[model samples]
Target: MREYLADISRETEVWTADVPTHMIHFNGDRFLGPHS
Candidate 1:
């Protein structure tokens, strides 16, 4: 996977979830969600 992701910046923002919830994101600006 390193070869495939090597082009992306190391300073890239990351968001991860193992469970499910409602996520509302606007453009590439911000994320609005209950986030619980």
Candidate 2:
């Protein structure tokens, strides 16, 4: 599932949870980070 997400991430926006109160947005248009 992880690899699958990474593969399709090239075209769409993917969001994953890093912690109870943190979120990560993966995309090709910008950098990485904990948006909140």
Best model number under lDDT: 2
Total colliding residue pairs, candidate 2: 0
Among residues 3 or more apart in sequence or in different chains, the pairs in candidate 1 whose N, CA or C atoms overlap within 3 Å are none
User: Candidates' TM-scores?
Assistant: 0.28, 0.26
Return the TM-score for candidate 1, rounded to 2 decimals. 0.28
Model 2 C-alpha lDDT versus the unseen true structure: 0.57
Off by over 4 Å in 1: 1-7, 20-29, 32-36
lDDT of 2 by residue, 1-36 (tens): 454554663458666676745555667246554555
Best by TM-score: 1
Give residue 26's error in model 1 in angstroms.
12
Candidate 2: list runs displaced more than 4 Å: 5-9, 19-36
